[model samples]
Target: MSIISLSSGVQNNLSIMPRWPATQVLIDSLAWQKLQAVQASLPGHLGLILTRAYEPRVSELGRARTAFRRAGICLFGLLYRHRKEEIQDIFGSNGHDLDGTHIDVSFSINGQRVRLLPLSVFTPMSWQARRIKKFDEELSMVLAALLAQGFQLHRNATESLQIHCDLKPVL
Candidate 1:
């Protein structure tokens, strides 16, 4: 488990809030450190799997399913709890919480715990843009898979949706 502490100056400078080049440097440095920690703990079989969407097609779905079968736990940097308005106010943008200048990755604390921590000091906007595209693409695949497996959109359904399949045919 890797822990990072920011310098007092950087931490205290929050009053001015996200001061250009200097703050960006610190953010990038922190991101690099966290990335190293994540790389150190990855399973041999998994290698470095960036959080990206697989295609919705059958072949891509099969490949994705196989990869997931080998994964025990998956941690993502998605900050879904915050509303879009809140994110816009903070970063002057109207997108996901992580679309800000700072890049954050899921930091694993132990075998069972994980937290989202900043990945980079002022990373390039292009990098952020590419990642967000991949993330959204992957989400689309998720929806595709859910619907392919017999799930439907329910506006306010109370009960849970349970899907069962007998593997005899595929086997």
Candidate 2:
């Protein structure tokens, strides 16, 4: 099983606390499309493992899991977020809890495990513009990187692109 790690950095200017605008088309369609594309490209049987942690709403987690299942993928592990005070309740060290250093999602394909870094921003206003741009850039980079590694894209009009390769694991 081959393991791949994709790392990305967020702009320091981008606020973690987002105040999304109401009329941000960039956040709504393009960002969502990019996210969907990335999620869809993930191989089935891998987990949506979390690297950097965050307080994801239960609904959002459920939706993500549902989307994975619907796409014939398996949900595996999670990385939980903790505040400074809550750090002791989870991990013992502040250094270990640093943001954007871990996987936000993980999965196994063809017996190989992969982790998705949690660099994609999620916020209400991100539904408007900023998040969408980030999403597009990130997804594009992911696609290009995968292609560079010899992964080929398979188009499926009935659904998302179905990746095909001899190494692809059986779901």
Best by lDDT, which number?
2
The clash count of every prediction, one per candidate, is: 9, 17
lDDT of 2 by residue, 75-133 (tens): 11122232223223222221112221111222234434321222211112223244335
Worst 10 residues of 1 by lDDT: 158-167
- Residue 16 deviation, candidate 1, in Å? 31
**How far does residue 55 in candidate 2 sit from its true spot (Å)?**
32
Q: Could you tell me how far off, in angstroms, the CA of residue 4 lies in candidate 2 after the best superposition?
A: 14
Q: Give the poorly placed runs of model 2, Cα more than 4 Å off.
A: 1-134, 157-171
Alpha-carbon runs more than 4 Å astray in model 1? 1-27, 49-101, 104-171
